[model samples]
Target chain A: MSGIYSERHTLEKTESASETANEPVKKGDTAEVKESVAVNKMRTEFAALAVNEAFARAAAAAFFSRLDPTVEELTEIKTAVSEAVSNAVIHGYQGGSADKTVVMECEYENSGIIKIAVSDCGVGIKDVEEARRPLFTTGDAEERSGMGFTVMESFMDRVAVESEEGKGTRVTLIKSLDISYYGV
Target chain B: MKTEFEITDNILIAKLSGEIDHHEAADIRSDIDGTYAAFKKKHIIMDFSGVSFVDSSGIGVIMGRYKKTAENGGITAICGCSEYLRSILYMAGIFTIVKEAKNKEDAVKLVKRLEAAESGEIFQEEKEAE
Candidate 1:
């Protein structure tokens, strides 16, 4: 879980607002498209680990590539986002190789929302509610702060954890880029 | 990440530097435990002199080290904590068992005295030979 999202807010308190209905993948052009910077990035799945650095780098490249994020807010978003990715890898995989891949998708929805989906097809969670509890640990040897979700919630505007006991887990996060909290 | 170990008068000093979060805890635990197992020291001093920022994951690492020391009948002391990092340490209750020192010499002195008390020998000929 290691990326930076300074101008974003976490949505931990809200339930799953996942519409599940996939709108047609709209490719926006600068002249015709209402939204200026088109939102699209491709990330390869390799086990479960913090992919925020990759995502952040991509986002920074696509959106704020020319502008740099300040050190403090950069650290905040990087740490929290990385932690969220780490949680998906550790808890979602249950430390098994069988849980082969963790899928990550990053897209910009207009100028207001940046949506991220980190999904894993491993042993899904038994309790989504309890898992979000701070200081919770199910790892025998893995040292976790258990505040990954908390930090994610604190940092992002929307955090939705989708999991089924036998299936896997997917965390969808949305954040706003309108605020000046993030460096240009 | 650098880990150094040395035994002086039955006290093992494990110096750890750099950022150690959840990702590195497992391997560090194994290395420290393996070193202590070989030496069987009565006291352990973990010098946190060069650490910058430590998060809650660091708390787990400290707790694991504390457990290891207690189980081996040795006390764990953490020294060289800066004023800036004291809050994180305090929040994690690391001060409860992990003792701090002004410097390395002071920590070594404390460990020597503890060792002397434990073995009940201020100067033993055989212990001094090896």
Candidate 2:
């Protein structure tokens, strides 16, 4: 647990620094102050179990609710998160070893942009391009639709994947909430 | 997820509720398959009025069932999907293989009509009426 926390702390520092650098310097503007204060992030790790898929989705939805996204937007985010977490549990861990952990991190900017990353240190994908193809899956044909990556790509504004064959896989999903719907 | 089954004129109507993700899809697949086989139904109608959320796993379940029924010369129809779910299904090309109905009744009627046409019963009925 300490190791995970330390890793998360390092990630948080790096993200915050980049965010600060990208932020425009606007003096005496309340909106700018509010925007800077709105940046928030969360990270959690759980066992790579099938049931955790639901947990992961709910957690993401709850965290993002501060943005006051519309029902459709929230549903899309939840579905995309579910796909990423499911891929981690089913494919990353190769049948969901309870001992393995899947880490999920979410960060939101005041500008209505949200980014989510799901990672697993399991048998990494050998061919990411092939894996991203629609209807391409190495799992049981009867049980997998092979549309996880496709769903994520369609539902989110951007989807990125990084993996090392023997190390792990990390999927990052980004979406921008409707500006009118942003509460925070 | 929860599924309730009803048989009408030999068509299996499965009423599905709750979120359909990988965690629940396994149970749903088994439930639908078990009921379909046990009842020896020739066609199936999946009612999704109560389904709140679905991911690719839901698509897989539908595809798997469609393949099973199609191999046996039967058909599959889905009804009661919310707008989001319908879009997902359409994106997955599920509508190419599975029929979409307005509701459970429409699905049953559609399957019955198709079955009648397949068995030439509609022609017989027309001739008898004439």
- In terms of DockQ, which candidate is strongest? 2
Report residue A166 deviation for candidate 2 (angstroms). 1.6
lDDT of 1: 0.59
**TM-score on alpha carbons, each prediction:** 0.63, 0.87
Q: Lowest summed-lDDT stretch of 10 residues in model 1 chain A? A: A5-14
The candidate that achieves the highest TM-score relative to the unseen native structure: 2
With candidate 2 superimposed using the best TM-score fit, by how many Å does residue B57's alpha carbon deviate from the native?
0.5
- What candidate 1 gets wrong by more than 4 Å, as runs, is A1-44, A49-67, A96-99, A105-117, A141-147, A150-159, A172-184, B7-10, B48-56, B79-97, B100-130
- Clash counts per candidate, in order, are 12, 0
Query: Residue B75's C-alpha lDDT in candidate 2?
Result: 95
After TM-score superposition, what is the CA distance of residue A156 in candidate 2 from its true location, in Å? 0.4
Per-residue lDDT value at A68 in model 1: 41
- Per-residue lDDT of candidate 2, residues B12-123 (tens digit): 8999999999999999999999999999988889999999899999999999999989988999999999889988887879999999999987787778778888888763
